[model samples]
Target: MAQIAFILLCHKDPEAIISQARQLTAAGDYMAIHFDARANPADFQRIQDALNDNPNVTFAKKRIKCGWGEWSLVQASLNAVEAALDAFPRATHFYMLSGDCMAIKSAEYAHALLDGEDVDYIESFDFFESDWIKTGFKEERLIYRHYLNERKHKKLFYASFRLQERLGLKRDIPSDIQVMIGSQWWCLRRRTVEWVMDFCRERKDVMRFFRSTWIPDETFFQTIVRHVVPDTEICTSTLTFLMFTDYGMPVTFYNDHYDLLLSQDFLFARKISPEATELKQRLGELYAAKGIEFQISNEGRSLFRFLTSRGRNGVRFAPRFWEAESSLGRERELLIVVAKKWHVAKRLASKIQEVTNIQAIEYLFDEASCPMPDLGGIQTQMGKRARHRRALMRMLYEYYDTDRMVICMDPKNMEMFQDFFTDRSITRLLEVESVFTDDYLAGHAIRVGLAGENTPSQSMERLLPTIRADVLGESDRIRDAGFERYYRISELRDAQDNAFALSQFLTIPQDEALQIAQTNHLFDD
Candidate 1:
């Protein structure tokens, strides 16, 4: 078996990272870490002390300050790769990952695949997915480019013609330009790592792209691989359990879509949290009972795994009352938006009252004095805020099941309530869709006549001018030319369909027009 070196780029999360190291050790993989520059010596020593007990663990001498869009991150990754090469000369494959990431696959499975794929595995990185409009050239912002299916990278670059002048960066096509991506956290053969390092040193513009782009993490390697490598595999996506919710919070516990999480086809999971210790233990016990040994690296030693489909029968987990049907006739159609504080909640409540004309009965619970449920009864703590939230959600579902009685909040807080709801059926609860940031809403508005007819045309018309402005204003040192091509060439075909036409641009669909007119009391023109 080829030895594997798993490297974690750790920051202030020393405890979490250290735990991960221990987990890695259990899985029979070697571990290494590069602490962020901001990490305290004491914190670093704490992690060091823990890992010092293990002969296999290697801690780096220097720290890296990874800039989001700069070469710092790429350099840091390279540093780890170099260290792994030197420390574990016998290790044939090196897997790079972040402190926030977790492995979902058993070590045997991952190592087996890496051993077979004598080549490098980096995940795909398209230009549009990179944060171009949000952080590229200041004045050139192409927001619609992402949605356009057929646009080419060249078209986008030409669109942002002004980028060259602003950044003084020139794009010249060399005879050799490679592209490849697999897992962002990938298993690289020794030669592939060395080849990558040499290629980066030789490519000046590539380095410049890494230095100037908003997020060069994926793009740098992807662009280079496509240019040089013969056969590379796009490995895994980065979205994992942590991206599903605002986890790692200090006070409250959140329930995530655990079933969905286990369903991912990927072998490794990113951003596994330490806070889910209880859940992890349960998973481990379940797996052990089934005679399947779940393993983790040193940092992730305490992680748990169970048979994916048996959650319902194996455990008597309580579903959130709001997420469940009300036993009493009073099921409140309340929307609770979670926020940082009560004032923000109050302000949001006022906005909902104004827009939907629904008044929410506000209540407060302090965390310090909150009563947690005991075996037979809930021990009454008088003032915990989370309890108040639980009590309020329960009341809404129990006492107020009416048309006007609805709850609304930002998507952030809705995630927190994920623990309370298990029945995903639409008929069970009122789901107040957010008008903000939901493109589906915009699409539905046109389909249902709530938005003006010719909305699609108007949306494109509104969109095209912005595209022109962004193109004429930015730098060309973007992730790739793919985004430019995708937006410019591809969208024209989509624009031809009537069904695809936005409501603001043309006459609405008859079925939808009627629904909109009826809902808003607008007469047919």
Candidate 2:
């Protein structure tokens, strides 16, 4: 078995840290602890005393007064790594972790997984290409030098920084180095760790540049490692499960997150708090029941057996959809646009509001010939025939706060879409008729719909083919996509004719329909 070293950064809760160290302790393993210099010396001594009997446990001599979003945190981790390698010459791999982290997998499983791989498991993304830079706040953290500890003059400091940036006085990163960012926690081979340290030592300017950058701890190691290590030798996952709040802060894991944690294929989970003592105890019991031992004699043999057995079962647990659903809170209204003839739009809207009890609005593509009375729960909007349908969609989204919308060719098709609004339905359709604009937009909104009981897996099997029939002539493409599960409901099939009927009734020229369909990319493959 390859000797593994864990470099853990701890600042609080000595008891929890000790428990974590004990759980991970085994032969051919080393645990190096780095207590933050700001933490009480008495507490640090208590941790050291508790682990004094274990020869594998050691503490770093250089402790850093670490602060969030600061370089000191990186310094502390580097110190722990140095100590681990110096203390355990036999160590082959090193894992960086925080005190709040707990191992979800057994040490044997971890060793087996790592031993089979010769790559560094660190999540890294090019800074310029990352969504945080592309879609989120851009260059806010990079352009200005950050002093994380200067809280007293924060507003004035930022104001001055902004002034400097507006004047084109931005800080420049080294031309030789490319900035990369990732999760602070990572597991890497000893060689990669040594290379990163050496790179930082040789490039003092790069180190100095990162010291003033915001959240440098996330970028410093990843940038150095990605630059030094070959791309083939890097695995783009940190192998750590972290639950973050909407604001991007790691939330404390409690009893409620137990199933969520278990569903992930990660070895460790972080930010578990003292309040989660009961949860930790329960998890320990579950691990014991699963027969995951702390140590194994044959290297990689037990892990290979466990993995093969699991593969034979062919069952993978997906995170409960309700977890994401609950986070989204309330379900948004679905906007349906229907044909203007025979008051079909109003009737369909009223029926949907009555049956599903969901807030829905109907938009008439053509100007209403007469004043339509509001049907209490259902709302109506009329658009000029010359106006593009996408304009109406934008107006609905802007004025009504409608989160999801669908355009229908006819009102008779409304019954066929009732399942779309049903709580038991998947809410989003992977494939829909090309005429249906906002398919992706609606899918995103509904993907995080309100939380309740989960829909049965068979419900998706029944829903897709029924909707497929109404989608014109894409049957071959749909079937080839493996969506042909033969759920024949006559109501769904009959609705397919409504599009043609409404075309005739509205006297909509064939040329106009063809043009609209072409513009919407609704043509069958």
Please give the TM-score that candidate 2 achieves against the real structure: 0.58
RMSD of each: 24.6, 16.1
lDDT of 2 by residue, 1-525 (tens): 666789999899888888777767743468999999999999998998999999888888799998876778888988898888788888888988888887766666677888888999998889878764433434666767777554546687567777877898787778988888889889989899889888878988888788788777778888899999999999988888775544556767787555445545677888677788787876654432444533211112222232234223223344335422322113433333333122334444344344334344443443354333343312244433212233333354455454543333343332223323343212322222223333322332223231112322233233234333333323333334332121111122234443343233223455443332222212322
lDDT of 2: 0.59
**Residue 303, candidate 1: C-alpha displacement in angstroms:** 23
Off by over 4 Å in 1: 116-119, 125-175, 178-183, 201-205, 232-259, 280-525
Expressed as tens digits, the lDDT of each residue in 5-40 for candidate 1 is 886777777777776777666656677788776668
Tell how far residue 6 is off in model 2, in angstroms: 1.5
